[model samples]
Target: MNYWLVKSEPFKYSWDDFVNQGVGTWDGVRNYQARNNLTAMKLDDLVLFYHSNEGMEVVGIAKVVKEAYPDPTIEDPRWVVVDLTAVEKLPKAVTLKSIKSDERLQDVSLIRQSRLSVQQLKKEEFDVIISKAYEN
Candidate 1:
């Protein structure tokens, strides 16, 4: 299964909102690269829920409930979205600062492309972050 990271500001759409909704179509992605990432998603893929901007941390995990589909919110055929359901929140959030400092996470797309809202994650990178989040 492919791993991914999707970012949202807490005020715009927080992890709690996602949990409350049960499942949601991840939308509003305007950038071409981010849209391409969404198109790459597949059913049952795992996603990391990140609170960008204000929070700057990876807060929860989610699963792709549906594959890429035309984003219903717009008429643009170039845009698409994927359905995702909240799996669980991390015991401890892995902060951006911490990720930037970690040798294992140095090559993560999150640091290499700081402004990317949706991006791919290597399994090792994903595993390392999961390990860090579970660290006591």
Candidate 2:
């Protein structure tokens, strides 16, 4: 399955809010690249939910429950969204600082394109982040 990371400001839509809602429609993407990433997602693809802005950390895991569909929140036909369900909260939230400090993650999309709301991850990169979260 493909791995991806999606960012949302905690104050706007935190991990708790996602778990409470059960399933969320990941929408409001306007960028061409980010929109394309959303369109590339497939059912059951794993996603890392990151709290951008304030926290700047990876907080939880989610999986695509539905593939790309016309974004209901906007009139623009170019935008689309996917349905995601919370898989689990990470054992520990992996901070951006931690990721940046790791030599293995230097080339990660999170670092290469910090401003992108949606990013893809290599399987090895995804595994490293997961390992970090579970570390003592």
Which candidate number would show the highest TM-score if scored against the true structure?
2
Each model's number of backbone clashes? 0, 0
Clashing pairs in 1: none
Candidate 1 lDDT tens digits, 1-136: 9999999999989999999999988999999999999999989999999999988999999999999999999999999999999999999999999999999888888999989999899999999999999888
lDDT of each: 0.94, 0.97
Give RMSD to native, each candidate.
0.6, 0.6
Candidate 2: RMSD to truth: 0.6
Global lDDT of model 1: 0.94
Pairs clashing in candidate 2?
Answer: none
Per-residue alpha-carbon lDDT of candidate 2 for residues 1-136, written as tens digits (9 for 90 to 100):
9999999999999999999999999999999999999999999999999999999999999999999999999888999999999999999999999999999999988999999999999999999999999999
TM-score of each: 0.98, 0.98
